[model samples]
Target chain A: MKKMMYISAVTEALAEEMERDESVFVIGEDVDIDGGVWNETAGLLERFGAKRVVGTPISEGAFTGLAAGAALTGLRPVVEFMYGDFIHVAMDQVANQIAKARLMFGGQAKMPVVIRLCACGAGTREGAQHSQFLESWFAHLPGFVVVAPSNAADGKGLMKSAIRSDLPVVFVESRQIYYDIQDVPEGEYTVPIGKAEILRPGEQVTLLSFGYACEKARQAAEMVKDKVDVEVIDLRTLKPLDTETIFKSVEKTGRLIVAHDSPAMCSIGAEVVRRVVAERFDYLDAPPVVVASKDVPIPFNDELEDYTVLSVQDIVDEIMKISVGII
Target chain B: MKKSSVASPSAEYFYRWMLAIRHSEQKLKELYIDHKIKGALHLSIGQEAVPVGVCAALSDGDKVFSTHRSHGHYIAKTHDIEGIMAELLGRATGCSNGYGGSMHLYNYEKGFLGGNGIVGGGISLALGAAFSAFYQNNGQIGVTFFGDGAANQGILHETLNLASLLKVPFLAVCENNGVAATTPVEKSTSETDRTKLAKAYKISSLSADGSDVEAVYAAASKAVAHLRAGKGPFLLNLRTCRWEPHCGIIKDTRDQKMLDDWRTNHDPLNVIAGRYPELLSSELRAEIGREVDARIEAAVAEAMTAPAPELAEYKRNFGV
Candidate 1:
């Protein structure tokens, strides 16, 4: 059986990596003392000492910057930000220093820095300030390897790869998938970043999704199967995106639909669509579609938030509309 | 454990370093006035003693972290005024290869970790460097220099707390030049005693007169000793005056008389050097001017002549 929540997968990944690499450790706020805000980092602190399982102050920029500094110097630091929103405070460290350090120095530095964040605006009534789909923002940045894992298996596998990878990696987790259970093999299994997984293969239409949107895409693909054949591809990693696979699928089916939980405007979906239009324009029989959340504030009320967020049916309906030419 | 005076030569050297920095700034101010320089450059005119005193005491293994107004720290740490000049000029031969201009000077071999552009940004970064020094068991002491404005940054206090709690072998210096930008310290906070704040983190903290070379040197010596003895993080608040109105081409004129008075009375280099009857003025001034001019000239020439970083350079990444 696979674990459900993205947090649990992250926990399993951290545990396994810490066991493997002596220098690997997690440093962040409320991580050791409180087992993390979402209860993802539970019990790892007890296993690791105060030295390894560092409980830092409210200074997100410091600990994150500290992790980058440590990674550059010697140790492999897996720094966690409680929310993706707080990354803005440490963007200078993340962008200018950490991301560009290795490349800026003409490869003299490795920058084995793995920055993790509880990402995506999944509806839990957290309101506007707390919720934002910031994956695309990082994906746009050069030298930043952006990862958005969907299932439990990918979480541990991708994280392990992130720690081992020489480049700077941003391992973002979907808050909505932390508790969701899926069967993950009980041993060490590494997932290669930049490889997109084909969840379900079909011929009529191709659906690109990742993170929380994977669940919706799967459901939508299933429901619209009788009407149109749906091929769902989970882009586990956004940067170093499996563009070859995405374009190949587009070549086969001559149709594509991109969906993500982030705001639709200037998002990954938009970028993907632009790339498809520019590179693979001749392969498409019709304009490639996108199913994403509205460009507005994520609400505090549960129902309103749910209304704002994507659903399996929404993906299905949007794809069907494009396929059927109802819109 | 206690304050001690720097050697007579060391005190004189401090004066020389201060003069060099001043002349460098004067040269740059002309450039800024001439519209040759781009970007905001924060010059450390009065806060010279902190870097000179601290760098004089630290061994080669010790690391330095500095704030936006960081030319003095970089010069004090590396003593390469030429690299600093090329850097401020944004020349290709400059440290960081002209990628990081005035505020982001770096020379890891010299243990000049960086001249950080962000205010109070380098504090935690220094803590990590200190942690590396600890983990590597190199006994390397990390010192991060911040402006009085950076004291108000909440992250700095947090890092101080962590550094103290973990007993990280590091030192934090707050160059309290009475102002954070245009706002004076009196307007910034009611609690004038910043040393008390560091003490709250259980780290040994003290306020010292930043202008006098002896006073700053004595405080830095004690602070560095405590850190070297495995006593963990230490804080030193330096109360100095910005001899220039923040930087060249000043707009704000709040207290011109007070500022003028400070510039006249608190000549930091002179304050310590003047008290020494053993030193002669003409000889020292001649030597100082000669060295300063040589440094400034070499740095500018190197920067101006150096090739710019190729546009193709940033496109490549490290291959595994």
Candidate 2:
């Protein structure tokens, strides 16, 4: 195992996957000479050359659509949407054309395209246009595999798995953690889609989250170490959710707290809360407390932006609030 | 009578396919009036020559992404008359297993990507397919067929620019039928000439009389040859006419004199028959007519009996 930055892990994953499969290539604005706006795809242009690492015009709809069309014709194209918020510009290509092609065409075509985007909502002062996290929007759509890995290891492994997948996948990454370093396993490895990893095991409270919120939940778990024995489950895949892992943890803990960076309304946490209530109503000792950002647009001011987003204190308070009398 | 000098050996096949499209659409109209095939149907009655000409220029490996008015495109490419009939009628044996109706025809093996519902949506799709061919180093070209309304879409401009910039082997054929649903092109678009839009993107383009299959064939052959030689994307703006309403059964809502003029001068079958009546002899015309009618009739009967999609089939398609 070697310690690597989150951005390095992603670039390494793309490099390894492209080397492994000749059909896999990266297409986006500034991916060639600029080496990606975030530099996650840096040095790939020199390694793969112009044809493989293409620099497209800032036409999101056209390029995203080009990836989909290429995927249908036997190329695994990883489309880079500089910001997750920009995905709305190409939603028709994502939701209508790419998603519906296989099903509406009676399963004649397989869409093997991955849309990688930076979805961090706080810090960097990038303002509202670039900082919104919209994974819930994609999870609601059929024929898409939505994933957001919180750490470098999972980021590299999940991206590899997403590239290998035959269906369309939306792999959301964070700008906040691009330089954050973590120990990633050496050699080829793939974290399977639609599975959860239990970071910490305990019996009092089950804390579930994904993306950057997973890190916040881990930090909160440490803060409330003496108050509540918290079990943190990282939901790797949002669409084909590992309900089994969630249910099993909830069964043992008898209390739940869902956390994510997006707004509380109809977010991934809301879906998790709904599923637990629907499937395991009897196992719950208290209502599932969801710790999510306030429902509002991300403000430009750093202080206001921090106020609207989730924090470790928020997770800790929610965990203690749900696990009443455990202290 | 004026004669056609275009005498390729494939003229017989082109006439048969065009006649097949014409007869099948007529049958679908009768079925729609009888309340058999439900939903909106965009019949390409007067614009059969565009698809026939463009498809004749393509090989089996090439792909065509079509628009909502796509019956002619589907028929010309695969000649799968039965599958298309079943698809329109929403039968299990349909190319899309009864899921895709008239506006959503798809057949991957024959390389008919789809009849997309969105205007100008197929341009990016076809461009992507062309890019894929270039990536694989395979000598395959992609053709997209859209209407005049789709020409005004922003994605068309974007795709045109991108396709030209990348120099992908692609063809964008605009079957300019003059009207978009109910609105005329003059009222809707400021730039009436769509080929100018292509030229602005630095892509080479040409225009042809869409009703004249020989002329359309000549234009498409030239464009296909250019694209095949690694030149770049080419655009063909076909001036054609639509003989039916935008959707549903053919209604007499169009101008009587205009419709009559188009029927007289630009009717695809009449244009060929008038030019070289011997090319379609009385016996050959009757034979083609009987064959088309019998095939459509048999397909309709089988489709009526074909089973509907089940719950498991839906689950399988969703990959659940």
Using TM-score as the measure, which candidate wins?
Answer: 2
Worst 10 residues of 2 chain B by lDDT: B1-10
**Per-residue lDDT tens digits of candidate 1, residues B224-313?**
778877888998888887766665567754588887877788878678767764673768777878978887887787777777766666
Clash tally, candidates in order: 14, 0
Give the number of the best model, judged by DockQ: 2
In candidate 1, what are the lDDT values of residues A161-206, reduced to their tens digit?
Answer: 9999888899888887887777786768889999999999988788
Segments in model 2 whose C-alpha atoms lie over 4 Å from true places: B1-9, B250-254, B317-320
TM-score of each: 0.90, 0.97
Docking class of 2: medium
Per-prediction TM-score, chain B alone: 0.92, 0.94
DockQ of each: 0.36, 0.70
Interface RMSD of 1: 2.6
Off by over 4 Å in 1: A1-8, A34-39, A85-111, A119-121, A124-133, A141-143, A180-188, A300-302, A325-327, B1-9, B252-254, B279-281, B317-320
Q: What digit string (tens of lDDT, one per residue) describes model 2 on residues B168-217?
A: 98899999988887788888889988778887999999999999888899
